[model samples]
Target: MKKFILILSVIFLIHTASAQLYIAPGADLRLAGNVQVTLQNTDLINDGAISVPATGRFIFNGNGNNQISGASVPYFSELEIAKTGTGLLTLANDIRVAGKILFTSNLIDMGNFYIDLGSTGYLDGEDENSRITATGTGEVLSTVTLNAPSGANPGNLGAVITSSQNLGSTVIQRGHQSQVNTHGTGSSILRYYDITPSNNTGLNATLRIYYFDAEKNNLDENTFELFKSDDNVNWTNVGQSARNTSMNYTEQTGLNSFSRWTLSNAAAALPVTGLKLSGQWKNGAAWLEWITQTEYHNSHFNVERKYEDDLNFFIVGRKNSAHPGGNSNTLTTYHWLDHPLSNKGPVQYRIQQQSLDGATAYSNIIAIRPDVNSQFIVSMYPTLHVKDGIYLKTGGLQVEKMHVRIVDMSGRLMMTREMNYQSGWLKLPQLAGGAYKVSIKSGDHHWEGSFVKD
Candidate 1:
């Protein structure tokens, strides 16, 4: 028994000497100051909290395994898993860093942990700032945590992280990364991150992004794009982020699959100022009215609507913007009327602003329902004045034939036309500028409408 106890003591002492880590009960092992710790060809195990300061550097460079459990606070410093050997580091704790945490050519197993980029830290491929660049093909079973920046300097809030390897998940708290504002007078600001969402969650994987102006106090009305890519080079604008009013943060949720997300203010100076859309039931019709503040290189506005169960929005009306004031700083008011064939229970409406250069943006979505009884009815397009012909739809109702007539204000029939059940359009004869009445009849069904000829 004594011989066996001696052998066990020897083994414990050998491991204690080889590890070289300060082990304590309920105390953290810290690598502070300008300390440089290198794991050349062996595994390093730490059971207590591991704290590394900004001036400290931790390098893993061997074929052995390194495991850190309790908690790791690498505050605004550099940590590298070098390319020398097949090093595998398992971090089970929640790590908070403000500098670079890289995997040059090794592996890092996060074991479903969280890595918090507390103040500022990015993953790899950075030029002027610290980056988190992981070039290895290793697997990361970890989640990224991004806190909201509440400081005066917004540039220290957001992270510019990019990884060649796929990431598991990301959580963003409400925060601001303030870049100096040259708003209304300078080049637009842009920030983008490249990441590949693991197919483990399929395309239903969610990425939550919280955004606020880093330097500016109030959130400016700006445009942001969420882009996705299969190859890191080619990108597709998946969708736009929606502003969350309660949190005062632009929260972009519902990102299923992605290779990257890029947010930019292409037309930052062309502030939206104010945008509001409301619908009301008036004389069996739904009236939609909206107002816009500042507009630049504005082309037109498209009124779009969707039903409760529908996932797609259809353009219902169009209003040309004659920003007559030309890049006006004044408010512009617009209106549209929707005469639905059927009064649906719930319907959503929004305005799509198209720029002269074909770029487009959307206003906040508004949902409203008809106050009166809902039923299928025939409706027409271009209910307002038009220079060309008009389209009439039966709201998908069955009609043997359609008979249409146009008359002048004096009640004299100016023209008459007939259409089959599958017909779509009715051409009108040129008339002087005046209001006219249009009547359509099919068996017992009848619809009387009016329009102004331009």
Candidate 2:
């Protein structure tokens, strides 16, 4: 409070003193070792210092609409800091600052900081504190200022830091990119085990399987599910991501693969190893498998199935208990039959591995067949297995002339050819190593999705 009074007193004295140079808008001014200002202009001044007297103050009043800039190459602010080591400058209203503000001292000491004030600007660094605070619905964005060493490592595509309330530590560094797809349409995931929990129960924890690329943004769209376990093997697909774009996951590509499963209870899993579930499913029953090559928490696990076509994986059957595991080397397996599937055409099947904490994990889809089915007979002839030019063929579909385009993951069109094939097969090209989209366009029928050349 005393400092504030003294600052105000100085302003009162400056307004009552005999000013040398008056700085208003559009006036030209100059200064050497010492010069005064009562009024000045908006344009810059040639190389010179406009220093006020040791006991006096320099007031730069732009009246809120003019600029007071400095001249000279890489020119600094005209009113430098600590000019006399005792002089002070009071600016009225908000002023724009450009260029480096040099302290000039071994270390700047004794100053105050203010904002939006021109007549009495804040004394910077006087409090020995500096901060970057945002106002008025403003957001402060974080960045990676450290650059990877060139040649040492040009760049890497993965999470540099990941933390949560699930595992032991709050940070984990993954790989080159689990998300890298032969065709860009596929998704990637990186799992962590260390986090800070909201409660003692593990079910309340978050599972952040993240992807940090323009290609990995789909994790934001797709549903994130928490597959549970007592033993790490045989996980059950328990829940979904609340923030998914398309909660109705008809299309797998847009689902939020980054899942943060909140365990409903507190279940210790320090003894488990095989903690992941494969999403691939078949017929009415999807696959539920875990690779608990290590174990500690030796709880029994069950495979449950659900159908989004109607309801979720109602309980199907339960599996028995397993050995409390360790990470050294242990692998476990548990499988069960799924029941009450969608009677309609094709119903989705997902395995939810449940833990004591009420945590869950949904296995990949295993398209279940109703006892009878037709194999895709999907024979890519002349055999796409070989590098020989790969092409799309719908000549037998009785479809008319159409345009089929193949695009790489980055959404770049790779191969596009007009197809007039009315009978057997459509000629295509064997694309470079990676994923491609074979989109068939005919009138209103347009198809686009992910495809692998091999």
Candidate 3:
């Protein structure tokens, strides 16, 4: 019962009259065809090997739940998938190839599978070389596994996994599931193997898994967790690794196996540890300040403010991040000022920290009630006067009562008066004037101006 079909070094053709071919599970077969294979079903448990010629096409109809548990033998020639149905093809086993593996199938289910590539192998869809594309309407989960050469603790490979959204271009990688909340329509999930650096061997000496949001931007490191699986059914938490926030990628320190890896839960994360943010008001302006005890690839800070009881905030100012005394461990201080807060009520403030790579975080929101008097603008005129008298003007949001006081440089009170008009004129007693300070107080609002009489 030796069930094997070897079409080696010969021109072999497989053209079924009914446009369909079915191979049983127990039939262990090997193929080296030079023609197109259409409408074929190699049922479950068929661990056959395929070796198509350079000009041949091994086409599979993606209609039913197809399974490919075969190797590409010595090399892969032209393997095509005609996406005629809506079902998925699960690569339950490894398919090591050194040639092209194209997919016409709209979707390839990989939530519990892997596409293990040879040391010099890569996957190519119709869009680009070294890319695996998804053209389906439903969500597609894809993961690529790479192992270090010679089974080293940490190795590298030259492989690229690229896919677009179901509609447009929203490329996502491991650890960015949070993006699906906003950009879920045209999105696909991509996962990769993480590797460390020891005896560097491959072209790209590092195996990195980039985590990006639905907007094609790198995701923050603190927003996700990493997990690994051996059987693809039961997964184990591998703990989140130290991320390169400025680069929006996490580098696995001591991983070398060919297991399935994933990045999940990409929601908003709190400010990094040892970060302190505060706000204050001075001279009719709101000032925001933050201090970080340590930093890593920190990019910039955005200051935002929200009106009373409003949950949404808008950016009002931005400050570039600077290291503390030329290093990252020292306490770094940053500040920004937002003058004339929009109509003076209870204003809330928060700082948004953005890393150079694309990671992001937010500080605790702080609220401050600005002085209602800030809405009133006070102005006074006249330096050297005798009869014209000094004019006092109070504009913007009229006040019921405003008290004015004139004091000498030596703290001697010269005159005090109260007015209710929006504009008024005051006559000060004749005095040997060198410098004097005029103070105006209206409710909780106070303003001070200076003048010198000759």
Candidate 2 residue lDDT tens string, 1-454: 5334533443454444342222323322333344433332122222323323333333333222222333322112323333333323332222322212222221111112212211122223321122212111111111122211111100111122222322221211222222211112122232211212222232332232322223222344343443343332323344444433332121111212222211210122233334444443356444455444433333445555544234565556666446433122345665554544322323354444444444444444554433322211112244334354544433223345767676788889777787674324544465677665556666644434444555
Q: Which whole-number lDDT from 0 to 100 does residue 193 have in model 1?
A: 40
Clashes of each: 13, 94, 3
Compared with the true structure, what per-residue lDDT tens digits does model 1 show for residues 119-218? 3654453222222212222121123532321221122224233222333444332111222211222122233343433332333333434333432223
Compute each candidate's TM-score over C-alphas.
0.37, 0.25, 0.33
- Regions of model 3 farther than 4 Å from truth: 1-27, 40-44, 48-57, 69-78, 126-454
* Pick by lDDT: 2 or 3, better one: 3
- Show model 1 residue runs off by greater than 4 Å: 1-34, 39-47, 51-276, 292-296, 305-314, 322-332, 341-348, 361-454
Candidate number with greatest lDDT: 1
The 10 consecutive residues of candidate 2 with the worst lDDT sum are: 149-158
Off by over 4 Å in 2: 1-298, 307-309, 325-334, 337-344, 356-454
Which is the better candidate, 1 or 2, if ranked by TM-score?
1
Q: Rank by TM-score, highest first.
A: 1, 3, 2
Better of 2 and 3 by TM-score: 3
Clashing pairs in 3: 165-186, 175-263, 246-357
lDDT of 3 by residue, 312-359 (tens): 999888887786322254557887888744343567888877766667
TM-score of 3: 0.33
